[model samples]
Target: MLKLSNETKVGILTVVGITLLVLGFNLLKGKSLFSHNKTIYAVYKNVNGLMPANAVQVNGLVVGSVSNLEVKDKDASQILVTLTITKKIDIPRNSVARISSDLLGTKTVQVDLGNATEYLQSGDTVYAATDGSMTDALKEQLNPLVQKLQGTLSNIDSVLLTVNAILDTTAKGNLQDAIRNLNATMRNFTHTSASLNGMLDPHNGNIQKTFDNLAAVTGNLKDNNQKITGILDNAEKATGALANGNIDKTLQQLQQTANNLNQTIAKLNTTDGTAGLLLNDKKVYNNLQYSLGNLNKLLEDLRINPKRYVHFSLFGKKDKTKPLPSDTAAVQQ
Candidate 1:
């Protein structure tokens, strides 16, 4: 091989460098020099940070790239964009392309392949859309978490405020008062428990004796149950008899007797009956006393002078000539 001069070598190197630069620039803009490419147009209201060189995907696989973007109508709010896809891939006429965002905010184009039998020609207009933006997606995903975090923070703040309030002097005093009241209640409960325990103590015997007595009484009642029932039956029969008008007849008779007694008492109180006169007449009492005295005197005189009053003789005997003082007084008169 023949060697060139320095200038010619330099010129060749510079051209090669410039060619590499051009190729790199084209690659950075999503152009492939070695592949056949097809261009398609789309309209969107917003591209959402979609730029040229952004990847184009069909069914989640990278197949092409976004090549251009433009504002088609400011008044209509339409944005036109161009996609460069591999010419070998047939896109259906009814396909739509949507711009999307990744976790890193890098943009992409996703094509929704359609079932239409008709295929799209190169340079034809396609449908376009975008799923908001990276920030919007992040907000959508994190909203509930953020709200929960805010609520947790609010609860923590309230708890801290409560702690601060509880640290105050008045709160301390109230707590102390509550403790004192609790202690007092505990003491009262202790006293009550002691009193109850004393009453229940086995050594006291009183409670046991009372229970034993009650048991014995209950046993006796159980043993006499038939007798008691018989007595109760008799009482019930008597009550039945009284209920059959016997009690009314007896009551009537008792009332008549009471009326008679009342009338008798009234008459006796007025000195109309014999008992009343005997009880009330002082003159009759005096006459009875005087007659009793006279009878007593006559009995004594007869006892002393039986011969003067009484005479006797189956055969006539000589009459004694006894002269007493009363006989002589009578002769003189």
Candidate 2:
């Protein structure tokens, strides 16, 4: 190898320094000189401060950078932006590249992947959109609130004017009196709150004692759960037994008995049967009465004249006193 002159060596060093400087600058700008990156295009009405070398992110991760921007038409009505993706991600053809900004106003191209099996080629155009910047978003969010606040202020102004128109010296005095009453009501409410707090205190309150008593009752109920269950089970079994009994058959029997009794009563009300005749026929009743009287007299006679009825003399003589009614009947004959 031939040795170089000082000037040539210096020139070579200068070129090498320049090349390294360029490489360093590109690296700082997030560009890989040797990277096999994919290039895609997008058209937008506004880029919203998207610059070349701005980070192109996919799901919040920086995968590439914005490469170039150019006005698409003579009127500058739209812009064409070029994006370089260094990763091997399969971006769908329908994917959108939205220009977004952070809180610090650092803009980025956020890639929103789409659901399509067909992927974008290196030179394909992605759909472009501009997300509202932080300021724009804040303005959009606060506009309604501002409108409502303005309306509220106007309504309050109107109310103030109305109050000024309506409130004379006497009305002002009454208003002051009302405010004083409200303050007193507030004081009363404060006292009531203190009383309620006292009622709710755990150490000294009747409410707390009532709660403790309720807790003890619940504890007792829980302790006697088994006994209560047994009682309920026995009651349920008794009710089940009653439910399963032949109540319909018993009712049928009772109804049949009532029917029979009713038939008996009906027969007794008629003079067709002997019982009916006895109960319902007056002639039969009189005859029965007479027969019962005769029976009673016969019984009394036997009791009084037992010797006439049963003669048992040892001398074999009859009771010859002329049977009681025989003499009287013979004289009469």
Candidate 3:
């Protein structure tokens, strides 16, 4: 009976040990005590900061953990990473994986379920990407600025040395004379400014009259403010009406008018129409010159012999006009 009791105790302990081992395995796989999960693989170029057992996230939520990492092929260019995520995560077939981190180097695998209607199956491989860290970017951006600042500081030092040399040279020369001249100029400026202030005093009648004129102008502007506002309102309404009206039709009409004007200008540039002939041909210009010459000749004739064109008659009979005796005597003399 004692041997049977010892055998039963051993069996009970063995069964408990087996149950504990199963629970530990489930916890290590990141699963519930009774649930199952799916495994997927992704490959990366440089998993520099990534390690095994790092959490995998989808949209910043922890969904899985890395299970294994190894060289994908004989070529060490790519590294393979296996993830054991929950079965609830429906990763797409064309989903991508990338290494991400916070401000610190706390790395994780980020998954992107791309726009695939079909979901990823177990043992499917995800596309991998690598984005560099912000520290590298900041260093790259600051390098040139630091170099420029150093160059600027060197230039400033050279400029300061040259300025000091010039100042020392000036001090050894006629600097005292320059200082005296400056003092004299300052005194003259003070006197001139006092004279100007006296002339511009507010109590002066001319200044008072100028202020009164300005006040009158401001008063007039204030009185006309309503009229100005009304004009502006009317202009705004006209602009708004033009904008809200058939603007496209108006633009079409304007285009048609422009086309007609262009046609007219083209005709004027050619020798086909009357205006075109006048503008482009020389015959019309010659005719105009000839007509002007004839007009001048007619004027000269009228000036020389006005009696031929001008005639006078008395009320009852045709008047026989004769020159006055004094004008005739003057002509004879």
Estimate the TM-score of every prediction: 0.50, 0.49, 0.42
Per-residue error (Å), model 3, residue 280: 81
Clashing pairs in 1: none
Query: What's model 1's overall lDDT?
Result: 0.85
Full-model lDDT for every candidate? 0.85, 0.90, 0.82
**Per-residue lDDT of model 1, residues 199-264, tens digit only:** 777767567678888999999999999999999999999888778867777889999999999998
Counting clashing residue pairs in each candidate, in order, gives 0, 0, 0
Highest-TM-score candidate: 1
Q: Which sequence of candidate numbers ranks them by lDDT, best first?
A: 2, 1, 3
Q: Which stretches of candidate 2 lie over 4 Å from their true place?
A: 167-333
Give candidate 1 regions above 4 Å deviation. Answer: 1-36, 41-55, 58-63, 67-82, 87-96, 101-107, 112-128, 133-135, 144-167, 190-214, 253-333
Quality of model 2 by C-alpha lDDT: 0.90
The residue pairs that clash in candidate 2, if any, are none
Candidate 2: worst-modelled 10 consecutive residues by lDDT:
319-328
